[model samples]
Target chain A: MKILIIGAGGMVGRKLTVKLQGAGALNGQPITALTLADIFAPEVPQGGIKTTSVAADLSRDGAAEELLAERPDVIFHLAAIVSGEAEANFEKGYRINLDGTRLLFEAIRQAGQVEHYYPKLVFTSSIAVFGEPLPAVIPDTQVLTPLTSYGTQKAIGELLLADYSRRGVFDGIGIRLPTIAVRPGAPNKAASGFFSGIIREPLAGLEAILPVAETVRHWFASPRAAVGFLIHAAELNTATLGQRRSLSMPGLSATVGEQIEALERAAGLDAVALIRREPDAKIIEMVAGWPKDFDSQRATDLGFVGDSDIDEIIRIHIADELKGKIGRGAA
Target chain B: MKILIIGAGGMVGRKLTVKLQGAGALNGQPITALTLADIFAPEVPQGGIKTTSVAADLSRDGAAEELLAERPDVIFHLAAIVSGEAEANFEKGYRINLDGTRLLFEAIRQAGQVEHYYPKLVFTSSIAVFGEPLPAVIPDTQVLTPLTSYGTQKAIGELLLADYSRRGVFDGIGIRLPTIAVRPGAPNKAASGFFSGIIREPLAGLEAILPVAETVRHWFASPRAAVGFLIHAAELNTATLGQRRSLSMPGLSATVGEQIEALERAAGLDAVALIRREPDAKIIEMVAGWPKDFDSQRATDLGFVGDSDIDEIIRIHIADELKGKIGRGAA
Candidate 1:
């Protein structure tokens, strides 16, 4: 089937595109024609099939319609400014996150009415959709009460997806992802960056700063598991999703100290020692507001899985990010 | 303090406006001015309280901002096309219900930033936010998975209220009202009109048609209770609401059989027999989709009240609607 991957230059989008472009990609149904879109043109993948790279601001009135002229069978929407950036810039966030999404859906809905062109849309949401005063372990059924602009925007998107999907305008599924642990590449402004940075930097012999107390816990999933989630989401029959179209996904809940110990066990004590402890009030406030654990029974039953422990998570990161070349403080 | 009541010509809006005019209608402090707006201007209430009526489409740009220019201290937003109308005209539903609500919030948020003009907003939501396959009785904590366009609009409004409230941009509270029974009016297009029409028309010596099975149950409140819920929402402090700002109000659940019995016991056999049975498949399908019961623990704990029974509800209608002289079927 023809497919479009919006925001193909971002972290999740890049991985998902790579996974889809690999030889024998998408085990069952192969993607026939591929279009990769982002604010900036995406790096063209060379898997030998048809591909197009279109760079344009998605919030523009007819950008989505222009893309839909290709009539992709599947669209993976993995765009949006990150949580910190969105919270800080109100207009930009709402423009890109909320209006941009609506434009795409409206384009799809209108196109489908004219040309019978409904496509399976997989939107990547986040646990940020839940806010503070949460149950120690948030249940799959807790009402979405987002605290930040980013969270609120995501929650709004989820509502729109369910409504649009229900109206037969299109088929859509929103998977609320957990924090991707040991995220490779350089750290940015994300408050949750330390969650991955502490492990990633130390593994590469660079000392990493810990922003919050080691005892503070959070939910985590490997980037590999995230890719798996996208594939499963694309393949799952949405008829079983019923009315609750947005679902909490499964992941491991571990504290920073536990993550450190797992890193030490995997990469040895020298690598663990490269972790430095520091606290910023701003990051601490942001981390304190995030959900630490969830009772994600729905996704588990729906056949999504995550790393059993932090060790597996670290191993996956090393295998993916380190490229099998052992770092300075390796085991 | 200036207050605006949209949908003032509608049942709930009229009742709320009348009560506020009768009382001083202090929202946390004092009321200095009031504005009631709708598609048609509502009849002016007695008692000398400064009031203005505006008839303008909120779906248009700058309308909400223009309305907020007066800088009302509290805005009672009781506007919308109801269930049947919303479903009948899909475009109108999205345009008025979804886009109109968003534009109103944007106007409120913008006004709030100008010299700190945040106003207390009371939004009327509905139990239609819940669909079928309910768990015996739905709890206040149940996730919203609406099945219709009307439900989707209300759910989206609730989310926006929460998000806007969280920003400290405005103090907003959404009350999810049950179907108002003994609704004092001529039956329009609402399928659930039978709930009130069965008693309302029959008592007025006109034949009332029953469209669904006696076994089909639904939750309801009297028009008096609806006005009370709105007033209570305006009076209550939302600091206690935390992130879950929208609440499922307490209500009484009754089956059609129970309703007929209550009418018989209250208004005699003549009134009961004025009801004609004509099972409608369309209505049966529609009513079948509604929720029968709600846990309502939060609303109860928050001190909101509903009709004690169908007897008191009917008595309220007789005293309030017929001025206590039940001409023909006085039991």
Candidate 2:
């Protein structure tokens, strides 16, 4: 089986690639080759598999069609400008995220005209799609009222995927991913990074600033869980999902306070003590408008599972990342 | 007052232009000039003090900037392909409605850089934004889950308009127009036209097919009511609306059975007897997924009103259209 992963350079993309490479198979089918592409050249994986890394800007004309010409069995579309970058640079965001996605879908359709070369397209959406008046526990079926430009683009992409899938152009699944906590990287421009950074750094004994109020609750999933969702969605029978192809994937729900509590339990009180609570009003306002929880019954019914509590989430993070780095950078 | 009407070549567009010209004013403000634009050349209104008709495909680059150069006081953006057309021709629909709206808003923002030419942008959103599992009376805060590409485009437009308005780019109001009953002229490609055609034709003594069951219910507003909502939304105070700009407009709620009864009342049993029972499975399926009612409390508070019942809607049709052309084609 052949697989293509767009945005193979990003954190999730990197982790997902590693997981796919390690697993060596998807849905019991052996992976023969992997085509990894990004705006920048991805760091070539060290594995002994026939992995091809291509530096390609997928937004440009015919680029996606050129990539899809290889006829990969699965395509994981993870390429996107993060929220802060997308918000700050308006035109670039739309050009990359919205227009780029459209071009790719159209290219896939065009490519399919000659022969039957439809691949399972797994797209990563976000919680940014939900704006204010978000229920305490957001139902999977809640209307997408995206406040941010990135959110709007993602929501629009989701709609396009559904409509395209409905038309039988391709088999598609859009997963509205939660805030991936304990993200294993230096922070980029994504607005939700602060959520992960605080927990991640404190446990690593680095002093991390808490930009928002501690009471602010958010749905979360470890990097591992997100990869699991991508793999699951890629192989799952789309016939069950029908035209409403996108789903809010189930995730662990925890407030900042709970996150801190988990940090204390996993690492130590000393690690938690390294956390500084200097609330920035701007970040606070942005965070306040976000949803607290999600009733992702659809994803759950489809057999997607998440952490039961924040402690388990913390445990997973320590095990997967941090090299079991606990207790003020000492695991 | 200067007013710019986008999508002025459409059904409601023609009616609105004539009405606005006749009124010679909007919100007690005297009309100085009216700019009507669409992809097609709209019929220029005869009565406005100064009228400019521009034929421009708005989806293209720089088109909005050109339109905004005139700097009108208010704008009525009514341009959109109907649901059926959008669903069928997906790319064209998104290109015109979704991308076009964004470009327009961006143009307004760029123009505002010079002298703040932020017109009161009154967008004609639709009830198609709401799909199944809806309450009998959809509230102001109901989630938008459009089944068609057209509805998705409208919902996304509403979001962009609201977000832009909140950012102080322009004062925007999105009126979720119910199915406009009694559409004038020859039958067009609108799928929902049967709602109006069934009763109108039967009352005119022409045999009309009932594609759906008699129990089919949908929210409705006459073209007059639709115009009223547009005018009211344009004139209403922004202070009352605050940051949340889009709203569900008030309209009559009735089933097909009630529509027939109203036809019977207005045109008598003889005229109503022209109705024929013929079911089109495609149309019935389409109608089945439509919203039944709308809880338009916000629109009511904002001073937008609708006709009392289906009889009133039928009566308006008789007065505005038929013009005692009733029984001209009666069976």
- Give the clash count for each candidate: 0, 6
Candidate 2 regions with alpha-carbon error over 4 angstroms: A187-191, A327-331, B133-136, B329-331
Question: Which stretches in model 1 have alpha-carbon errors above 4 Å?
Answer: A23-27, A329-331, B27-30, B327-331
Candidate 1 scores a C-alpha RMSD against the true structure in Å of 2.1
TM-score of 1: 0.96
Residue-level lDDT of model 2, residues B21-49, one tens digit each, is 99999989899999999987799968946
TM-score of the second chain for every model: 0.97, 0.96
Each model's lDDT comes to 0.86, 0.84
lDDT of 1 by residue, B142-202 (tens): 7787888899889889988987887787899999999998898778778888999998887
Weakest lDDT window of 10 consecutive positions for candidate 2 chain B? B322-331
Q: All candidates: CA RMSD in angstroms?
A: 2.1, 2.2
**Residues A51-145 of candidate 2: C-alpha lDDT, one tens digit per residue:** 99998887899889878878898999999988888888877888899889989899888878889877899999999988887778887667777
Displacement of the residue A170 alpha carbon in candidate 1, Å: 1.0
